[model samples]
Target: MQRILDRLLDIFPAADRSFILLRESHSQKLIPVGVKQRHGEQDPNEELALSQSIIKEVFTNKRSILSVDAMDDDRFSQQASIINLSIRSMMCSPLLVGDELLGLIQVETNESEQQFMPEDLQVLTGLSSQVAIAVKNAQLNEEIEAETARRTSLQRYFSPKFVDMLMSGDVTTALSGKTYLGTILFADIIGFTAMSEAMAPADVLAKLNRYLTIIQKLIYENDGNVDKVNGDGIMAFWGVPHSDKSDEANAVYTALQMQRHLWSFNLDLQAENQPPIHMGIGLNTGDFVAGNIGSEDKIEFTLIGDHVNLASRIEHLSGRNQVLISEATWQPIKHLVSAVQLPPFMVKGKSTPITIYSIRGMESHEQNGYIMALPCHILDENGRHLGRGILTDSTPLSNGLCLRLSTHMEIERETVLTLQVETVEYHQPLVCVVKVNSALKGAHGGGSSYTKVVLTLMQEHNEDMIEFLRPGSCVATNYTWNDLKRR
Candidate 1:
């Protein structure tokens, strides 16, 4: 642009100064990009002011203007800028390319000795066309470069959906350090060191990629972002770059699906005479700091805080093929999932014991409704009747069931119980054997005199009763205690 300005000054010897002003796309304001003055000019670039009326006239009419003396020109004589800045001889041309106005170029002189000619305006018009094309190409190149850099930097941490948002200039403010409520998840392969030691280097790399690929796919499918890879583990989170109401639920969904998908993957290994691999996933929800952190030369977008550390701590406590979560993560999703509350645990960095829950499976919509009161028979593994209770709910995937009893049963944890209930149509018994996962006693002295029992089907036993224990099959039957007892 400065070269163009200097060339224009050389072509028009009468002009003392020339400038190129381009309209900013975002602000729609014209800003000076280049300025060239004849030798011995006293004023700096800031003092170079153009008449608003003349520039506006050129743009509005899509033409050029040549004024021998602007104080005598009817079109701009009344303009305050022309009178205040001193009457002058000037020429203005609209920079345009194929009907689009890019901005304009103007050349003027305050001396009475030099006045622009009609021929000079025609020459300036042709030059403005070439200048418009050059400026447009430069702008497009800048946009492309910026987009490429943004996508490359953000793809290292965020998913593609979020990458699009950041490139579009939305939520770019989130890159700064700020506190945000989010859910963090950590998933690690169990016995990874031992497994790698037993395999070749190429085999280990292949297996690790396959494992991490599955986890990465599931996390993006549930609208979460991968923060970083921690050795054999992956650290991911939701609610940075933007916030979503379903953040916690999405995190839980990703964790559960990751386990299910890995199990399916393990079946292939077992068939090939290779040892099956297992993984442990943990999730926690709380406020954390999200931003780009590191030295001036190297930085990465990641999360940091006590909540982030707690998520990793909880993952360390997870056993093989298990998904565990902090109490904060369970509060909002308890109604949607079936989980077992574990004893309070003492973590390394925390001063108090933290409550944790092991996620079993998702709760089906049919089982999330009000608990129905129907007599159910509980038997031992030998099919011998032990006692009776009220069946409440069943979880999805046919993995677990919930029951309420009148008195606390002396059943030990892990005790297998054969649960039986009659159907409404045929009055035929529907039975499934489940091991006791938990048993809690209510205050027997008060009106709340009931014991809640959570039961889970062992993996070996689930295949035989899956169809019977499936979620939608557990419907409420209209049978009274007398009808149930008579049978």
Candidate 2:
């Protein structure tokens, strides 16, 4: 543009300086973008002194104006800058592409003997037309490049649907930093350390890719944005780029489906003689600030807030193959799903205890129940018979059940226990294997005589356990192991 201005100045006989003014994108006001001066040392401050009245007139008429001795012309004589600059002659032309006025180019002379003629105005107008088209094309190319860069960057964080919304030129306000009522989820593989150690690096990478491929697809299918992926962990959220009423439900459903899909994935691994994979998912819903955050060189569209951290905390609280959700997340979808309320536990950052629920599944036809003092036989992983224990509680909606055994008898944590439980619903006793999660010593109808142990079902037996514990599917008599043997 400066070269164009310089060339124009060279074409005119006595033109002292030339400048181009382009319209501001946001504001229609004109601003100088390019300037060329004859004397190079011309006072920079004196350049803008050109008559605004003449420029406005040319822009308003969409044509060119050549003034001879502007100090005598009544139209610009009252202009203080024109009179003060001692301007003698000037030519202004409007730069237009079709009907859109891009800006204007103005050239002037201070010499009194040199006067701009009608032919000068015609040449300036013709040159301005070409300049307008070139400027428009350059501007369009710049916009296309910017949009392409934006789309590529956004694809890393958002699903395709959301990427389209962001690129559609609508929802401009939502793109800025703002508070959003959204749902955040964090999921990570269980026993990843052991899995990584057991397999070769190549095998681990292939397995990790398979897991993530499934997770990524499910998130996009649910319209959730994947914020970041760190090794075996994934952080995702909904209600960004745009918010929908289904944001919370979609987040929960994504978590649920993720677990459901893992079942098949694990089955595949088992068939291949590979270790079955397990994951823990946690979800929380609340207000968070979402936007592009980083230095100028690198920016990431992610979420930031206490709720986001809380979601991570809840994820760490989840047991293997469990989906844990905060109370806030469970409130809206409480009626649509079945969940087991876990005890309120204190987390790292808060003074008060946070309440969380273990999501079972979508609303179940069976009511949740607790069975007490049912007899069961416990065996070790090798099928060797171990001491018998009493089933104190049946939590089919959660990831585990509670068993009562003698405190003196020690059961190592993570020890697999094969349980042969007799239920009246089926002739054959319902059999399943579970792993000891935790053991709590307590006094139950006696003086600290038993240890209450928490057990989580092995992945292969989870479905069988749920079916066995379903209400009305199992009848638990208050008979202890001793009483049943005596009868």
lDDT of each: 0.74, 0.76
TM-score per prediction, in order, is: 0.55, 0.53
Report the C-alpha lDDT of model 2 over 193-291, residue by residue, as the tens digit.
Answer: 999999999999999999999999999988998989999999999987667788777888788778756755664675577888888899999999888
lDDT of 1 at 480: 40
Runs in model 1 with CA error above 4 Å?
1-127, 130-134, 168-176, 241-243, 267-274, 363-487
Candidate 1 local lDDT, 1-487, one digit each (tens): 7789879989999888888889998988898888887866536634566688988899889888889999888988889999987758998888888787889999988788889988888899889888889999999999999888878877766788878876777654433677899999999998899998999989888878877888898898788999898767999999886777778878987887787566556645645567778788899999999887776677677889999999999998776656789989888877665555665678989999998776645543433532222346878878887666655555545455667654335777788887775332225655666788864433131123345677786667555345443322322334443453243
- Backbone clash count, each prediction separately: 0, 0
**Top lDDT prediction, candidate number:** 2
